[model samples]
Target: MIFDGKDLSHRALADRLPSDETHVFRECDLTEADLWGAPLAGARFESCVLDGADFRKADLDGAAFTGGGGMRIRFNDADLIDASFTDVDLSSAHFGGALLTDASFTGCRMIGAVLTGSRGTGFTLSRSNLTLANLGGCSLRGLTIEGVRFDDADLSGCDFTEATLSDCRLRGTRLLDTKFTQADLRGADLGEPDDAKLRAFAGAVITQAQAAAILAARGITVL
Candidate 1:
């Protein structure tokens, strides 16, 4: 029971059994609240305004949701390990089976968010604006992303082995079976791809203008 920076306003705590395990509600607003089973670990909804709230099975560890506009919030089976979502909007929000380890989404909006089967580790989203984000089966192996801007993202079965996407923008992205095998797609832009975009940087271990802009966008315009 570590209630730091307390201010629990508009509290409609439902399914209550977690009698003050860790109810911070820091910088609180807790809009349309219904905090179910709130035994939330180290819970600190900082700069809060948890709109349409219903934190099911809450045990959010190291919680710190910086800034507000938390729309339609509902973190099902939440454990949110190392939780820290800065500049939040979290549109179409839903964190199913959440236990997001080392989670820290900076400058967050998370448009069209639906993080399926989430089990993150050092999941950093810098310069964030994941347009049409779905993030299926996220198991980012060796992940260390920089300047993130996943434009039109789906990233099917994502497991970027030895991952390090510097200056990323996989345009019209939906890279199924996504694994830049031995990753480091440096200065990535994929040359304005649109022709049924199927980006599978085969045995990818990049450089050299990112393999000459993915072989000059598959047109192989004789470099």
Candidate 2:
């Protein structure tokens, strides 16, 4: 149902929803609503404010959450296989322990979003803002992360095997135990890493200037 600018409680909205099926919630204010353990697979939520809403353990497979003003939304432990989130403002949202295999998030503002322990094999995050986001222990193998901002983000224990990170920002980002095996780092602004942080770039492709900058940070005279 189209709930443009309408504010409804979780119980009220849940009562109106059908059993174990897809539902459409457009432009609704579901802020801080608790939808824990709900069966909402293949549901579509467009331009809705779901900030601080709890979607823990919910079935959101093949779901689409596009064009929303939601920030700090919680999707902890949710099943998000093949889900698509486009143009959504999910800044500081919690996706910890979520199953995000084959999920896609394009043009989303995900600054400071937590993605720790999230399991995903295939995912695309294009033209998104992930600055200061936590991606610790996430295996992002072969993912296409174009034009994304990763400044000050925690990438500890994260793997970027064969991933394409073109035109991305990595200034002040934490790279402890991070792996970038055969990954492309062309046109990325990986601003001046120290010797310890330089160790994280062992198997990745980089520019000559980047190499010199890393060496300069290590007290080496780069002629």
lDDT of each: 0.70, 0.84
Task: Quote the lDDT for 148 in model 2.
Answer: 90
Q: Which regions in candidate 1 have their CA more than 4 angstroms from the true location?
A: 1-11, 20-33, 40-51, 54-58, 61-71, 74-79, 82-91, 94-99, 102-111, 114-120, 123-131, 134-161, 164-169, 173-213, 218-223
Residue-level lDDT of model 1, residues 1-223, one tens digit each, is: 4334444446766444364555555566777677765666766566777776887767777777777757768887788888888888887677777778888788788777777667656466766677778887687677777666677778787887878777768777787777778787766675464443435666767667656665677778645
Off by over 4 Å in 2: 1-5, 9-16, 218-223
Model 1 has a clash total of: 0
Residue 152 CA error for candidate 2 (Å)? 0.6
Listed per model in order, the count of residue pairs whose N, CA or C atoms clash below 3 Å is 0, 0
Task: RMSD for all candidates, in order, please.
Answer: 12.3, 1.9
Clashing pairs in 1: none
- TM-score result, candidate 2: 0.92
| Model 2 poorest 10 in a row by lDDT | 8-17
